[model samples]
Target: MDQEKPKSSALSEKSGVEQPEIVSKIAAGHIVALRNKNVAAADLISGILSGNITALSRAITLVESTNPEHLAKANEVINGCLPHANQSIRIGITGVPGVGKSTFIEAFGKHLTGIGKKVAVLAVDPSSTISHGSILGDKTRMEELVKDQNAFIRPSPSGETLGGVARKTRETITLCEAFGFDTIVIETVGVGQSETAVHSMVDFFLLLKISGAGDELQGIKRGIMEMADAIVINKADGDNIKKARLAKTEFNRALHLFPAKKSGWTPKVSTCSAITKDGIDEVWEMISEFLELTKSNHYFGEKRREQNQYWMLETIDERLKNHFYNDKNTIALLEQNKKAVQNNEISPFAAAQILLENYFKFNH
Candidate 1:
């Protein structure tokens, strides 16, 4: 018995994996909560701290949710995760419909995953101009890439914003980064002039286009070209080779006309075929080189800080709008004042003042 006891003690000493105290305690509490199928705020926080992707996704859904209770809990999770955020690269890709943005993204995402990089393809699809429902289904287009274990694809339905801004997308990117995703790609279904929202959020904006058509010069909206940090002519395969070549030249000229978006690093045009997977490496390399150059020149971090400020102001505007719309009395007053002005019963200036007074009275 004594010999057996010493042998057991020796075995325990050899395998002295103490499993760090903090980790064990957190896990023990989380396990109990999860086993009961009730993920509390603490469980969510601990899960996020350990970089559990599922927990992060669930937390984000809560944040994106409209339920008041969920909003409260989600805010807590966001606050807890805030300290661990902002480490990943934010890349925004925008192109008009039929530009092969999804195909290009699938190829690019697969390549990144193959190289041990985790890629999150966060997309904003254009909503119906009237009903405001998301039209382009980016997840359906990036099917193969969605199956990749290392790739996370989130398609955000565009809301009533003038642009297809998800409103929660910037928050989503920070959450993805906190979960250790190194590459964050935001795909905006280029719609009208509103697609400029992508430019304010990313380190670089990539404009994807199909190269073979002579329509290349007219295909991309002028504002997109102006905001683009790089243009990738996609589908450069098969019989499109010659046309792709010509299109590249056309874009090269077009790009030269635009003012430099990022200082010191001129935007370049590249070609790729998402089907054949040609030029994918070149595209990735160009991005890395551009990032290095911009970061070295100190524009990368500067741009991000400016973007952060933009989001703060944007949030303020959103909350103010909500404050107005959510007040039942304000809505009634707005209608009354609008009708009074429309009927000329009250002077336009007087109606405006009444609306403002009512808004402040309700708000204060």
Candidate 2:
């Protein structure tokens, strides 16, 4: 009886038997399709609305992707999520290098999380002139908030974009909103037109400044000043307190020169020490007031509508330019036209017209 004991499956090697293939536990209709990016757009949307961080991050990557397949998928996700967006408060923070934009965001973000508010920081880092690579090293600077469970920091690179904002920032905002982040803070790459770009997409625009950095007016452009909804003087601790106050007064005076805003809200100027965490709450309070005021006036909704239209036109313009430059025939024509124009055989406008005609013809 012991010698005739039934052998285990492995011991019965001589038996001719086939085992059924095992499927993955996680492999569902749409879940499996996610592996190949063939999942229906609604599934991705559902995942995001359910607060799945992985799905949210993946959707953002898709939104920023240049791959054709990912681009289509990204568009699907965006369209699906659009109805759920615009529920978050979007703040655009911009400052020149060394004004502690990173520090301020860190402290501000921590303050928000402390109050049980979910925060998302979209920090844009400057690309290196030599390597053309961005450090995207903001997380190191924002140590506390980076660790907070309610905080999500996404540092992106400013890749040759004139406005100091990433190309996909507006799209990224939508994804963050859908992820249930009630507050969004966008830190711009640099101090110039980046503010303008950020201003277009956000509900509030805050400009950070440092005292005694230079002639305060010279440090920020008049146009930039006009666009700011609030200006905060950072590093206002130790010996810089008096200087910061002076800068605050000077900024207030300059702000008065601009015509009144349509929102009927006067811009605010304050001083904050991000290191000591002083005046951070005051800044948030000001923002909350602005949101309340704008909401009451119905300007908040109107501004978002205007921004949507602006981005739509901007996207179309970008696509048209990309299409013209990416076409091989267009490139060839451009080279030939460059030579002709340099030799004075044809005017620049004439060469442009010829290239445009050919581009449209080929596409059509």
Candidate 3:
């Protein structure tokens, strides 16, 4: 699994000049510090490659950075670790705000662990600021799993995008698998009950819903319903038991409206009480059955291989966009061109064209 090592950290030294690594190190004082500011990240990346949990978390931080140099190294580290990746069941789970996504994950992850599966959770909520990392103390909420030796829970806010994924989530997924985690569960910041980007990259997409009778249907937009491979009426216990049952009936009726899934598994609408843990195994069985069905029919491997190609293109797009935006000259030109266009000195189209032209020229 040897990759041509990422051409040294030389690409990151600013000054608009690529200096020798020694010159950069001499100018910066510390060679080690010059690469990863998060000492934890280097250690963590090593752990991830070797299957260590603490190091895996640190590596995820490096991947999630808004900073440039860290991001470059993050890329190198994860790529070096990728041959060991893609071994897990990448499942994206989303639902409306009150759908108990965290609780269900805790239970589901426990079930995976009970059967000798290693599970990792990346709760994607992008609204979270640097000051606050994850949405809530789900680590506290899923206290049992948090402490489990076989489980690793990472709570990250879904970045300010509707894609239902946070920054660098793809890298985190890779890191999880490289560490020998076979089941990777990504929980998104449930957006109006629709599944989007996060689900697009996964092997199975699960949409959790609270059985709200007619009201529940209204909350879950039609688009999300269309994307669901499986829909579950969560919190199916106590007084809500009847409502959950009815919700399944309604969903089954509605699922019939859509075309058949590529995976060829009929989307099942089941009930589960994360609180009581009843039907937990049923949910697990449904997932296993779906996986077996897809894997047997060839969709499982084919879909994931397609996802890999998608990710390759996605990474190129993201990196190219970031490179252009981060080029200081590009930023300066963009601002100046924006004012010129606003003042009527230049047409908006010409101004944008200039930005695009200069971007390629400068980057080239």
TM-score of each: 0.83, 0.86, 0.81
lDDT of 2 by residue, 122-157 (tens): 998887768989888999999888899999999888
Residue-wise lDDT of candidate 1 within 111-179, one digit each (tens)? 999999989988877778788666557778889998998889988777776577787888888778877
**Which sections of candidate 2 miss by over 4 Å?**
1-40, 338-347
* Cα RMSD (angstroms) for every candidate in the order listed: 14.4, 11.2, 14.6
Q: What is the Å distance of residue 146 in model 3 from its true position?
A: 0.7
lDDT of 3 by residue, 1-364 (tens): 8878767584476677665665564557674564455564456667777766657766777787788777667877787788888788888898877789989999998988999999988886546455644455678889989989999988776655455577678778888889898999988877653266776678888888887645755844568877778888889999999888988888888888888887788988899999999888998888899999998899998988888888788778887888888888799999899899889999999988899998888677
Minimal lDDT window, size 10, model 2: 6-15
- Top-scoring candidate (TM-score): 2
Candidate 3 stretches greater than 4 Å from native: 1-46, 128-136, 192-194, 213-216, 337-350
Cα error of candidate 3 at position 8, Å: 62
Tell how far residue 252 is off in model 3, in angstroms.
0.4
